[model samples]
Target: MLCGKGLVAGYLGAPVLHEVSIDVRRGEVFCLLGANGAGKSTTAKCLAGALGLRGGRVTIDDVDVTAAGAHERVRRGVSLVPEARHLFGRSTVRDNIMLGGWTKSRSHRPASFERVLEMFPQLKRLLKSRARDLSGGEQQMVAIGRALMADPRYLILDEPSLGLAPIYVDAILRQAAELARQRVGILLIEQNVGKALSIGHRAAVVETGRVVLSGTAEEVAANPLVVDSYLGGAA
Candidate 1:
């Protein structure tokens, strides 16, 4: 399991996450739902080691990793697909995906590349294409493929479907579900509350930098707070 206990983090001394705690068990999709400025992305960064925690304990399988740097954490089987699917516009899709294998041995890359292609066959055809030329959905696929190159045990996806077509959104969320089936713990932060809960085994709602509600996806979907606020009162 990937767990963050009593997390406290922020930018420039202003705390954005206040004692926020979460757990992502292997083979399950753990959704984090919240409005803009609710600190969902901040929590992802902290868990993925891209941002430092002011106070907290991050553990994977009961091993402490709170002080580890981003690279170190990646080496320890953690990966992040940041919001907006940050891809190298000028770089080839192949190069962009290969970048994630920096932590692995050179010989391991070919097999990893093949595995990613198997997960996203369309990318195989776009390997030589520059990232900037792909549609929004394709760019997002590359972002996820890049992260998969690391063979992460825990993957954090932040707003992965934010600006995609509905079909692409379904594709992205389906991939998340597939990853969970492969026993990869998934920490998913998304704005599409209903769709997210549909695939999530468990979920939490964050408000004003704190976790306001959490439970089985069904229970969360049934909560009046979630229904009225995020699901338009019909969840």
Candidate 2:
């Protein structure tokens, strides 16, 4: 449902992504695996319209969104949950989630908020709580719930497992898998190689700003380069 072809993007004059390309199919979990500075986030930024393409194309369900800005892309059913989990620290959890649907009419916000709560029952109990007081796991849930309030067709998750305990990471990965089963196209950027591969339908191994390898989960798991580089020979 999403594709980036020969994408080149970066901050200022230094290019971080060099001709990277990948595709995410509907109802599938597509994993982008790479070390820090491998341009995984850069590729995601370009695909989600958070960064402009210096020389390439980004298409959503075959529609050219290469020139579209972030808000326009979100309107077209693309939403991003960045690595930083940028929640409003001073705001209530409910308010933070509601802000995600700001692009929608007032009539639709309540329903969207309820939908997010359904996906994350814990948030329902903490609606009035300040975002800064939540645990890492809860904060991550708020971040994801906020994006879901936008009602996106394709969800881009960047390192959702970052800085979390093993159980929390497992829970988040499981939730991500469930989202895929619900027909949401997920472009997952995960540092937890084993867990990501176990849930992902397909996986791409990136190195030096390029997609060095890509295939079905099993195929990628068997690749020596992938196992050595990312999986620590556990394949």
Candidate 3:
């Protein structure tokens, strides 16, 4: 399990997360649902070690990693794909994806490359293409493929489907589900509530940096508050 217990963090001395906590179990998709500015990104940063924690601790497989840095977390098989799809415009898709294997031995990269391609075959022909030239959906795939190069045990994806067409959104979500099936714990932060819940094994709704609701996906989907609020009366 990848667990963040009582996470307390903020920016510039101002708090954003008020002791928020979450757990990601291997082979399952744990969804975090919330409106903008509800601390979802902040939480992902904390889990990914991109930000510091003012309080609480993060653990993986029962080992304390609260003090570890981002690089160390990545070395420990935790990879994060932020929403921005930060690819090097001048770099080829292959180069950008290969960069993710920085922590691994050079001999391990080829195998990892093949593995990533399995999840994103569309990237094969685009290997020589510059990241700046790909469509939004393709760039997103590269970003995710880059993260996969690390062979992460826990993958944190922040708003992966944002701004994507329906086809791309479905592809990304399906890939996430496939990763979960491969026993990689997934912490998915998404805005498409209905679609997210469809693949999520467990989920939580955050509001103002706090978890307002949490349970099995079915339970959360069935909750009256979620139906009225997040599901928009569609559930």
Candidate 1 residue lDDT tens string, 69-120: 8898898888999997789999999999999899889999999999999988
Off by over 4 Å in 2: none
lDDT of 1 at 102: 92
| Residue 4 C-alpha lDDT in model 1 | 92
Q: How much is 212 displaced in model 2, in angstroms?
A: 0.2
Off by over 4 Å in 1: none
2 versus 3: better lDDT goes to: 3
Give per-residue CA lDDT, model 3, range 1-235, as digits (tens).
9999999999986799999999999999999998899999999999999999999999988989999999999998889999897899999999999999998999999999999898999999999999999988999999999999999999999999999999999999999999999999999999998999999999999999999999999999899988988899986
Candidate 3: residue 204 Cα off by (Å): 0.6
Runs in model 3 lying further than 4 Å from the true structure: none
Top model number, TM-score: 3
Looking at model 2, residue 204 earns an lDDT score of 93
Residue pairs clashing in model 1 are: none
Name the top lDDT candidate.
3
How would you order the candidates by TM-score, starting with the best?
Answer: 3, 1, 2
Clashing pairs in 3: none
Query: Compared with the true structure, what per-residue lDDT tens digits does model 2 show for residues 1-235?
Result: 7989999888887788889989998789999998888999888889889999888899999999998999999998889999898999999998888889977999998898887888888788899999999999999999999998888889999999899988889888998899899899999999888889999999998888888899998898889988888888865
lDDT of 2 at 7: 94
Provide TM-scores for the models: 0.98, 0.97, 0.98
Cα RMSD of predicted structure 1: 0.9
